[model samples]
Target: MTMTEARPATPLWRRPWMFPLGLLVAAFLAFSLPPYLGLDPARSRIPAPTGWYYPVLVAHIGFATVAMVTCALQIWPWLRQKHPTVHRRTGRVYVFAGAIPASVAGFAIALAAPFGPVGAVSNVFLAVLWFGCTVQGFRTARARRFGEHRRWMVRSFALCMSIISNRIWGVVWAIVLTPQLDTTFGGSEAALGQAIAGITTWTGWVLPLLVAEWWLGRSRGRRRAPSPA
Candidate 1:
């Protein structure tokens, strides 16, 4: 590419809809804490298996909220193009203040989730991926491998967005699609709901990551295409 070659156009991620969704999810996560603020198991979403789990959940939501909001900026192409320093600072916050503690608390909550073994295992996997991707992103950045850092950060954000996807799939599949698709999965509608929950628990994060990866590959391929002779 020549110096005169224009930089790539802004990607879909930087658009209004995408980053705003992250902010909305972050707000949702923040509001979620109030119900459990008094450590009232009754008001809590997962019912905190024990007294100890309550605080852990608060921490998880807090940090994951941070991750979601900050990670959004980390990927803005304009930030990369014009404000490398701000991007690095945001990346640090996303990893240190957000992803790491959230993973630990999230993993604990997943272990104690009343949903069942399938949901528990799925959450466990998500927590690990959440932590791993953030760390890898941080490491790559530290090593000056900015391109690799961006890829890993995208994966990290994809997992972070799973919070939104989980709710979406729950509403779509359990509330709408599943009933139309047979609704039984072998049992009653209640059973169908549980089945859909389990499926989305895994698919929520995994599917988004796969989609991001596909987009990244396609964009890279486009960038590498030969200029006309």
Candidate 2:
């Protein structure tokens, strides 16, 4: 092919893990959301304090789900590069209908989180970070600083996806620590469970954010590297 010839696009199947990861996310939501959709407080997976807690929790979940779905689309390279209009539209939905509401509701519920003090602090910090990154991303985009906008949005998306890691970490911790309850917590299962939950809550999001930062730094370095002659 001549220099002017357009290169053939890579097949979607050969693309990186995003598509398969997206499918896993979809599967998770499908399995996890049904119980909450019924809107009965009794069906809630988390223990609720009655009245306002359940309603706010439901609202948070709903909006976070919206953010989760749109963030995936927004970060999709094919859609962003080939269909800029769709990307922008979905970005608006992600900001207005998703991140804002979800983070606000998350902040509210985090104050009364049933998972104990460490989990509460983790949730609160996560909510604030999510909100801050999202708003900053929007601001950068508005200022036509596309590079900064992409970076900020990537951070926001990392926070959004951290919940999945949180669950995965929770399950792993539960499995490992359940057998140690008698020895470690004086036979108190509740104490052991709380300990695992708190530690995983921090590890879940913090670890993912650290990984995201490392990736961002690596990419930035690559961009700045001198091209081979």
Candidate 3:
């Protein structure tokens, strides 16, 4: 069969859980992420922010926070299908107000973040992808290439969701590595923090994007698979 003609159906087990789980996670992120954004880096576990840290951090989080909340609202299939206008408008906000400003400011914060060079690099990558994907999505939508727009937007949000994934990875890391923490970091909180930051940095957005790519590839492959006579 030709590509686009041999598409496969999703499994029943996969149908119900994804949406609810996403909403639950989104809710958790909404509730949990804000306090850290405005936090004085010195007062928080985050590396101490340096000169102009407060304003830059605020701008980054301000946009990112809106994106996060709106992203969750837009995730529902019903809203997209039934309220295209809403989707379009919110999507515009998510791109312009949320992802773009947040990413740029995040770049600055990352440079100043004490998580070390690895953390700095990871955050930089996140900032780049976040802005790039959102812009791509916006362009595609404007060009009326909706399928590509959907793909890009999905990719965009996967990056946006990194903040949540980072912490989740941290929790898992802590639990799994508690015994070896001192050995790994030589009893230095700075060393340990850097290690955790580095791991989470990659795992956060990288894993999600990898999964999205895999899913996208599988979908395309199934569509291209030959049909039996």
Best by TM-score: 2
Candidate 1 runs further than 4 Å off: 1-19, 30-33, 37-39, 176-193
Model 3 clash pairs are 1-226, 1-227
> Could you tell me the TM-score of candidate 1?
0.82
Tens digit per residue, CA lDDT, model 1, 1-229:
0011247646665576766775776677676657866766678776666768778888887788788778777767666556667767777788889889889889998988766688889999999988998898888878878678778877888898888878777776666546554534554665665577777798788889899899889989999999999
For each candidate in the order shown, give its overall lDDT on alpha carbons. 0.76, 0.86, 0.76
Task: List TM-scores for all candidates, in order.
Answer: 0.82, 0.93, 0.83
lDDT of 1 at 79: 67
Worst 10 residues of 1 by lDDT: 1-10
Candidates' RMSD to native: 4.5, 4.2, 4.8
lDDT of 2: 0.86
Q: Order the numbered candidates by TM-score, best leading.
A: 2, 3, 1
